[model samples]
Target: MVISPQEEPSPLLREDDRETAVQRLQEAYADERVSHEEMEERLDQVLTAKTHSELASALASLPGENPDTTSTIAAAGGRIHRGGTWRVPRILKVESAYGRVDLDLSRAVIEHPAVDIELQLGTGGAKITVPRDAIVEVEGLHTGWKDLRYKPPRRARSGGPRIRISGAMGFGRLKIRHARR
Candidate 1:
């Protein structure tokens, strides 16, 4: 889901988010992109950023993030729904606490032959719809309350992308199915 900058509750991110940003900045420093003084200045900006835009600008020159990078979808009590035509990253991390998740990847552009999905849900269920030719594997997932239900296609297509899902679900059930033709 895309959230406009104005619709955001608070532009300030959580402590963990700041920590991650700091780590990224440190990585950039290690890459020798800037002098020590410039790195320190950018770190200060990141640490003192008051809004999302400010923080983003602090790391705008960094050459780390890209479209194919691992993307994380997180929610704290809200729903996460993704569908339509979108670029599928190599690795996806889906996280939620009390909200449901729905991912429709039938029409998504899967560039890689293998994709990894790591789920972290608490008291919420998820429904994933994969392409008709994709192969899914959920053997590494663990559920606290209920088991997962996944229905595969009758005729599996070889050479398709492999979706590997692994994670823990608390008091929730996961349902996976292939998209209808």
Candidate 2:
């Protein structure tokens, strides 16, 4: 839904919300949807806005992240880990043949309402830590040796992150968990 000009952001808006807005602005700028000057101006507004309408105003005119954009991280062997604060891509593919993969999304800037993660692993196992409210699905995943180590919530609330995981792996266990409150 579009955020109208007069609509105010919640006073309880978290830093994560602001960071998501900023990430979207940067994505739009990178795609040439906005000129450099517009990017700079909106970035200033986003950085200064705190429980203020400026944040909404700055983001009101920007388009959402490109739906077709996909990013990949590949490791021939060793380890691959993503944590801390990072932008969550609409689609992400991770591949590793002989090492562990640990991805922690508890503190990520997830601009999109849904995200897809495709994994290809071997021997070393994997662990994915998602936001507490994320709704996760692994219907299309195939594991060679062990069953995936994820248990979905009985019921998920509306309007949280939707994560779809699909891929194939051999000789490793895949584990998923939501971040603790």
Candidate 3:
């Protein structure tokens, strides 16, 4: 057979080399780098991608960034004080291995003069210490166990910090203490 100089390669040959761009995008999403909005947008773009190059481009344009571990640790390991009823809009995530969280924020004073604390923990222990004279009112406490312990009160309202500990995997101990009366 003789080949013609004007002949061209078949376009169907390129289809076998096509990449699974949508699958790659899903993998990126599972890695927790891409936001929900970005994931949805990329998925839409990926579905409309006609060629491998176009799909690859869409994946490359995604703003997928991993979380910084140092900053997460610093945020998880600090103390905050408020003069009035303070509210921290964050769910503390402590690993099950650590099994213990010790916070010393008794110096915090609220407008009602009552220290209101709300501890929401998973499968770990929580021990919070307050000032001996500060009034303690625990709004809610959720954990994995029911081993709630409190130190003897030396002040008028320091007898015991009002608390509420409850959760699905409650298997931890909670202790409260104060030095002065």
- Tell me how many residue pairs clash in candidate 1: 0
Lowest-sum lDDT 10-residue window in model 2: 1-10
Model 3, span 40-126: residue lDDT tens: 888787666554344444665444432222111122333321211111112223333334566543322112322234454455566
Candidate 2 per-residue C-alpha lDDT over 15-113 given as tens digits, one digit per residue, 9 for 90 to 100: 766777778788888899998999998888888876544555677646654545899999999999876445678999999989999998865656788
Give the winner by TM-score. 2
**Which candidate number would show the highest lDDT if scored against the true structure?**
2
Kindly report which residue stretches of model 2 are placed more than 4 angstroms away from their true locations once superposed.
1-68
Q: All models: lDDT?
A: 0.76, 0.77, 0.43
For candidate 3, give the lDDT: 0.43
Model 1 alpha-carbon miss at residue 6, Å: 41
Alpha carbon lDDT of residue 16, candidate 2? 61
